[model samples]
Target: MSARQARIVHISIERNWREVYDFAAKPENMALWASGLGSGLEADGENWVAHGPLGSVRVKFAPENDFGVMDHIVTMASGLEVHNALRVVPNGDGAEVMFTLLRLPDVSEEQFEADFRWVLKDLNTLKKRLET
Candidate 1:
């Protein structure tokens, strides 16, 4: 299957990268944008764990400079597994977060596209909340 990509539109609130990074990195703040995720945020080493619809999702965060990237494995409510990477890049004004959803070989492209769109909408909501 082909990879699915989506972009979240956002404007910068505070120009300081450090402030942006810290706010975005906090797990509890995730619910401000995303749905069906972001509760029970916990951190161990460089990883984060959150209770999700599927049960639990473990995220491995890689942070550099003012940006952070994460690899996510989510077990969906339907028992399907999804793997994706999320990249948060500073827009030089604020930040633009991009999610690249990888479609597993056996996964249907339609499913991947639909889910990716949902994620983008959620992220956009999150951006507006944060920037406000």
Candidate 2:
């Protein structure tokens, strides 16, 4: 299976890139904007766990950095892993948040479109949470 489709969504937030990155990089603040994660993630030893429509999921994020990279790996209940490469970069006075969405080999076209929409929604949610 090789869907091999990729998409990137970016939103401009009225805040410093560092501030946006700091807030977005926190797992405890995920569910506040990321609807896919539902309510929130709870620390479970070295990994973070969350229960949502897809059931229990484990997530691991990249270590703290200065370049505003916020990549993360998500392990679904079904044992599937999704790698998300997210970034926050300065744009003049504010910042731009970007999320790269990948369509897995087994994902249908409809589901892929839905995922893009969800990513857009989540990015908007993040923008609102940080800009306000």
Candidate 3:
């Protein structure tokens, strides 16, 4: 697949960037929003893992507010490998979340679109969780 063929999703939150960032970036809080997705922070704070439909995916994060991006290598149960990047930025009133997906393994455009839709739903869930 072409590297240019990536999925990007954005969500605006109602809380300040700091609050949103701190809540979402922390491991324990992630479980609150990303329940059943196998997403959480490791006890050592060195890495985060989100279990995709495939296998246990892992990502290492820098210190908070480091402006560093987290990378994901998700191996689907069907043996498809997907690469993902997640970044959060401050926007007026709250924050903007950016998610990109690439290197889909045998994934069709329609499938990708569906994945993006699911991601948006997830983000909305997060927004509500944070705003309330």
Candidate 4:
């Protein structure tokens, strides 16, 4: 079965795909763009810990790969885990960065919309940072 609701928020950058991936895929670099991780991530064993409004969450990121896969799993303090699928792919001479935003069960419509806007805003911030 498919997710009841989802959105693919993306942005195009005038840089090489590998370059975009190299920077965007870094956990440290995410704080500069990702709002939810704005407090930044701290190293915790094989995973990273992000302290947010809901409390500290364990984040496990996909190992560095050449295929531009930057997926990661976020385990909330309550033990609920959310898988975030992020990627950077080639597009003409530039790169297209995409983030799959899934609306978890019981999330209000307004909150889901807010999440979509947030992801797009983050992606735009990424594009601005990488382009300059």
Q: Which stretches of candidate 4 lie over 4 Å from their true place?
A: none
Q: Is 1 or 4 the stronger prediction by TM-score? A: 4
Error of 4 at 90 (Å): 0.9
Off by over 4 Å in 2: 1-3
**Residue-wise lDDT of candidate 4 within 1-132, one digit each (tens)?**
664688899889999999999998888988898878858999989999888665788899999999999999999977899999999999888999999999998899999999999889999999999999
lDDT of 2 at 63: 90
Cα RMSD, each candidate: 4.2, 1.4, 3.3, 1.3
Clashes in candidate 3: how many? 2
On residues 22-124, what C-alpha lDDT tens digit does candidate 3 reach at each position? 7777666765665435655455355556664435655554456656254444444555555667777777767888778552656788888887887887788
Q: lDDT per model, in order? A: 0.60, 0.91, 0.66, 0.90
Candidate 3 or 1, higher TM-score = 3
TM-scores, all candidates, are 0.64, 0.94, 0.73, 0.94
Give the clash total for candidate 1: 0
